[model samples]
Target: MMFGSRGKARFLAAVEGLESAVRDRDAKRCTRGLREIHRAYGKAGDQEIAEGGARLAALLPELPDGPRGGLAVFVGACVERGADARRCAPAVLAGLAQALEAAEEFCERWAASGGGDFPEPDDGDPGPGVVERGGHCAAFGWWTLPQWEMAAAAMLSHVEVRKELDSIVRARLLRDLRTVTEASGHDFKCLEQVLLVLDDEPLVALDRSSGAGYALRMTGLGDTFQLHTLLADVLIGGGHLPGQAPSAREAAVCRDAPGQVPTTGSFNLVAPDGSLLWNEGTPADIPVVDGVRLLVLDPPPYRRGWPAGRFFPNMPGDLVLERVLGAEETAQWFTQVAPAKG
Candidate 1:
């Protein structure tokens, strides 16, 4: 997508303004003039974006994915209300808010300078463009990659972060694994690496409790799966979303393990729609509608947050609640927890 340098500048300026609004927690004001937040997921083809894609690629540890961006009618407004560009480490994603604000400013300034708006290019796919309802717009484009989907990239990042944490306390974990292997006559791996053992399992059932958080019932769990469902019901007992999942009589809980310990409440459940459960505390699950894969493992015990006392009895750090799936089903979920799919 070729736009005059002036146009690019304007869009970036607008993004900056948007970021400011987000940091200030002013979403409404930031997106006030924007007619729609045209959230776009690119398909492919473009060099400038390919370079941006390269930076995003760094974000992936093992599998790479597509580029994503959103268009706001008042792009500037949205940035201010929804982003925290300053928080990103590499400075690109982090500067998203600023970039958007700058783009908007550049456009407004250029238009004021009598630089007549460029002729509306033909209906060229132009990759990605932010169209304003009144025939105004700030076009932006990006390409989708083949390495992995955007949702997959988020999954990989979760894995990489988990590994970084485990490396810090590797020695202690190694000793524990050795003890488990020798005493149980099982080829035990380090608690920080159970993902390798159950990569293809399906998630059958889920359970959660304020006391134990989320847990799943695996296919092999057999009757055990039902048993977990029973226990989890008792654990999170009275907590549940008002009118979703399970039903008024049954709150099925996420039944998935934790990718990471929650930040608030004792439990936060991530239902299939990403709605969330009570023990599935805090509910930050990605929108399941997009097919984002999730890895639910027991969070590291030493991790911080909550009261940090007997949150879940016998909750092993490396346990993985395998999802037991058949040829055409999501895996069967079980109570075992594993290391983050690191």
Candidate 2:
């Protein structure tokens, strides 16, 4: 049976509650959200998401106690279903912070022991955009990186960084795959097949230097900082206006002069009907809304100041306003209608 409108609304609410729970790391909310999912799954009709939600609920208990663990479990549960990565960002950021702190501590100890400067990354072409490869990397190496790091910590006696990361890598020797294969109770030959598949995987790569060219290929443990930083950027870079673009001749008249827009956050301009008029950053680009000339303004500053404003400066308000208003093209078409000049 198809879900009625009320059912659809319930399903949507359940999803929203789940996302909020995940983002806020609210265990009570999560439990409520899971109940909502279980109750609404039949009406939702899409078994995959429902099943995914169940799997996530199952995984939640296995996770360590903390907000990070809850977020991580949420991220893992939603992995197969293309859950918004941003929703679990707090968890990812926490893990990255922990890993980076461990790495830095190791680095400092190594330098104290006369290791000198940490080696620079070898010169090579910039790797593919992290987002393009992040999913595969996260999926494959999710369990692997922490395992390897722990093994490294055990081997070194002290928690010191090793000059030869390759040495640490060599000792492990496809341990991740072997563990998974054994757990699967598959034939040994299946391991070979799995290797072949992994070899051709988009995110996986051969690390000739690290593995001594022993046919070792693995996906990179996607860098959390870089991935999220890029996500923060470029996420809001472009978007469309409420409606389709006006015809070409009509668009020409709406073009704002160059050098009038700010560089970043330029798409904040609002149309007369309160919808954003595309990214054409400029007041001049605003069309006559409801037969009245319109102008866009920057959103008001936070009443209580930003939560982290002391630690991190907010981008200038004037710059933000300019960026939203100065761009040349606008969704507002007023070819037949003239904007009043003051």
Instruction: Give all TM-scores, in the order shown.
Output: 0.19, 0.23
Positional deviation of 198 in candidate 1, in angstroms?
A: 10
Model 1 scores a TM of 0.19
For model 1, how many clashes? 79
Please give, for residues 1-342, the per-residue lDDT of candidate 1 as tens digits.
Answer: 443554444444443444455456565645541211122212222332223233332332211111222221111122123222122222222222232333344344445545444323232322232233112222321111111112222221232322333332334434443442343233312221321212222233332221122333221111222222323343334342121112222212212232222222322324443333333121112222223333232222342233121112112112234333342233333233222332
Which ten-residue region of model 1 has the weakest summed lDDT?
141-150
Query: Per the 3 Å backbone cut-off, how many clashing residue pairs does candidate 2 have?
Result: 10
| Top candidate by TM-score | 2
Whole-model lDDT, model 1: 0.28
In TM-score terms, candidate 2 sits at: 0.23
